[model samples]
Target: MIEYSTLKQTGRFIIILGIQILILNQIHLGGYITPFFYPLFILLLPFQTKGYVVLLLAFFTGLAVDMFSNSLGMHAAATLFMAFFRPGIIRLLSIKTEFEPEVEPRIHVMGKVWILTYTVMLIFIHHLSLFLIEVFRFYELGEILAKTIISAGFSVIIIMLTHFLMGSARKT
Candidate 1:
């Protein structure tokens, strides 16, 4: 039988996936920004989660989004890359003494600075990989770079806002 925790996580994933596809996918700032909040799901997974599980979840999440967005495999590649690098990023920015066991990442749990740094760095990496893959060539390097940075910035803001709102709800 599936564990209660696993079932809850699955339900939450489905809800987030629907919101991402039905809501966020419709939002675009003239090709300059596309808020990709789905990555935050993978990002905020418990730190103690196994690397393989993270990678698999990231791959499937990207693939699902790609299916909905009709962007082929671009999302999958970028997301998997982000998942692969997340552990190292956390290790780099996290304080060893403050690390907790099996804790999910959150602004409240990790503090504002750590959360901000973690989100920015991961968003940058994810956006860069995604833009590069979407371009598939270096002909419009400047345009791609601009789009990546702008989109990443927008995505970071949205993700943080969502995190804060969710955190507040959790406390109530």
Candidate 2:
């Protein structure tokens, strides 16, 4: 039988992906900020999840977004890049004794400041990699920076809100 946590995680993954594909995909704010909260799925995984598993999940998640967005492999590439750096970022942000078994990197669990920092760094990396891959032009560096900053801001906000909502729901 499937474990409860596994079922919960699968449902959460489907919901996040559906929201990104169906809802977020349709919204284009000034054509500059395309929020991608799908990364939150990767961010909130259990702390003990294997590195290879994270990479695989990131690839498939971003591939799904690419399949819908038709941006080729930009999302997949960006997400994989972010996943590659996830362990390092976690180490930088955490003390050696910080994580307990089954703890996730959620706002309520890890506190607001830590979550904010974690989200900001990873989202910036994801957005920068994504925009760079999408444009593939160094001459347009200014525009790429503009899009990455603005879009990362929006994505971070949306992802934080998701954490707050989900964290509170778990509390009740």
Candidate 3:
């Protein structure tokens, strides 16, 4: 029997997945701007989550998206990389002694600057890895770089907007 918290998490995951597939996936602007809503799952995870669990979830999350989009394994590789690096990124952004034990990654708790830096770094890493993997051959390095940067920019904007909206609700 699953606990209530576990059930709630499962529901949240499903809802986010649906939003990613049914909504965000259709908002692509040519090949340059793809809003990556899946990263929110990674960003919203509990601060104290285990590394392995994070990695597995990231891999599966990306794989699921890939499966739906027919993008092969690129998303899986990129997301797994982000998940693997997430803890380290948190540590790098964190003040260590000042970080709350059970806090989630939010603008309210970590401050806007920290959250912005964290999102930008992770989004860049994820987009770089994803486009590199998709392009495989470096013959189109310029194109891939352009796509990655543009897509990352759009994703970061969406992420910050989502954070601000959600944070405001939490404050009220």
Candidate 1, residues 1-172, lDDT tens digits: the string is 3376578668878988988899988987885467888998898788887789999999999999999988989999999999989999988986573455457888778888889899999989999999999888664888888888889988999889988998999899
Q: Mind giving the per-residue lDDT tens digits that candidate 3 earns over 1-172?
A: 2376468667767877898899988886985477887888888887976678788889888989999989978899999888888888887777673444456788888899999999999998999899898878764888888888899998999889989998999988
Q: Give the alpha carbon lDDT tens digit for every residue of 134-169 in model 2.
A: 878554899888888989999998998888888889
TM-score of 2: 0.94
Model 2 ranges with Cα > 4 A deviation: none
Q: What TM-score goes with each of the models?
A: 0.92, 0.94, 0.90
Model 1: pairs clashing at backbone N, Cα or C within 3 Å: none
Question: Using TM-score as the measure, what is the rank order of every candidate, best first?
Answer: 2, 1, 3
Candidate 3: clashing residue pairs, number: 0
In candidate 3, the residue pairs with backbone N, CA or C atoms under 3 Å apart (3 or more residues apart, or in different chains) clash, namely none
Model 2: lDDT to the true structure: 0.89
Best by lDDT: 2
Poorest 10 consecutive residues of model 3 by lDDT? 94-103
- Per-model lDDT: 0.86, 0.89, 0.84
**What would the C-alpha RMSD of candidate 3 be, to one decimal place?**
2.3
